[model samples]
Target chain A: MAIFRWGMHFDPLAHLRQIQRELDRVSWPWTAGARRIGGGTYPPVNVYESDAEVVVQCEVAGVEPSDLDVSITGETLTVKGIKKPLPREEELNFIRRERGSGEFTRTVVLPNEVDAEKVEANLRDGVMTIRLPKKAAGKPTRVEIKG
Target chain B: MAQDKSVKVKTTVSAAEAAEDAFSPLVDIYEKDDGLVLVADVPGASKGDISVQVDKGVLTLAAEARFDVPGEAYSRTYLSFEPGRFFRAFALSDEIDRDRITATVSKGVLTVELPKAEAARSRKIEIKVLE
Candidate 1:
């Protein structure tokens, strides 16, 4: 089927500019920022590493450890999980939806080459941890004197 | 804009609070000699365990910050931490050297150094005219 090309289509650049403006309108936090939780809850996820492995830890309160899925292949590591939003009835008075829900995929590239065969992942206390072993080079290097 | 196909039970809060909470992490873009330096505020993120990824022209970052406060004593009255997965994505242009992009997180702050292509970096040239 032939597609219709109308010259009056909205400009993409203008739309992008509008999106930028809207993004700017968003209220931003500073170096130290946090939010208030109505009920008992934890904080945002934090990721870090150690001498032995490149570790990733996420604070997924109210979420079971079994719900998380982590995969690592070569330099790419993916963490896809779900956070079931808190349930409430009796029509919300009216406000905003800040928390992101449903499925989430977080992929990171390993800083150094890693051994895909020995990668390990663990989850406990609503925190998911992924450990990747660094690839080891065989044997130490030796130098010979030349005349 | 409100079209509801079904009624579902969910948490309902004020719009203003939600708006303020949504974009909690503020990202700063710095243009340096290397390329673009992105410093993002991931409050709970630690230097040892932050994830930075670049695919095609898209960049994604996620981290987890542990307070280490034992048990219920750390009851949050006003938790600035969103207490969930933090995600951010940026569509990069040719200005970024994807292969050379280096990222490091220190003290809950993430620093990403996007190196510029060799040709894109500014360099001083000597103009010598020979007869």
Candidate 2:
């Protein structure tokens, strides 16, 4: 059996993970008795846009500001960070642990053209907010109708 | 490697609470020398809005998770998550010293320390050698 592909490497884990991601997405509506302990995406984010700017709000609780890196290129915004596990994992007797820890990077495509220079990132109470102001061309302009 | 052990701990959801559909934040529980430490991810929940309570040998973590979003939302092409009330409850074993439990919230995480009672602590007996 050949696992080779034209331009992509054969990664079984990634494929399985993609399926699992879809399964989790389907369960989003039903919130009954589901622990949701298993890893979904880290730093869950909310995106909304206004006339002036488009903002992305992310949940980064327990993650340090120093550990995070946010960057944008074209229409994509990437957030990368490391959530260090509790100190001395082996030493402690864990009864239960659910919060997953490791380096995670999530990239999102912005809906509107934004002025990257005006982008502002702020961290407060473990939440990260990134503001991307709309460029002059990106903003909507009203035009007069011709007779 | 330690993940939330949903099996060992017993939990209950009242009908009223179930109707509310609270988000169960991920939690990690481990034992230290003196007590057990619970760390939970409750992003966007303010410190004042979180409530840690011990009643009838049950420990409950509840929080009102409020978030901030700028401007009126347009027809979003992509979305990830929603903010809601967070609720998780655990049946505390007798070994825990409920009176001494303390908690703190930082950023969007909540850490709770549940100390072990004096009688529940383990001690090693000294051995004597006679020449």
lDDT of 2 at B105: 82
The worst-scoring run of ten residues by lDDT in candidate 2 chain A lies at A1-10
Every prediction's TM-score for the first chain?
0.52, 0.68
* Candidate 2 residue runs with Cα over 4 Å from true position: A1-38, A138-147, B1-19, B71-73, B128-131
Summarize candidate 1's per-residue lDDT along A104-140 as a digit string, tens digits. Answer: 6655655556778888766543445566766775588
Off by over 4 Å in 1: A1-147, B1-24, B69-76, B128-131
What's the TM for model 1?
0.37
What are the lDDT scores of the predictions, listed in order? Answer: 0.52, 0.75
lDDT of 1 at B48: 42
Best model number under DockQ: 2
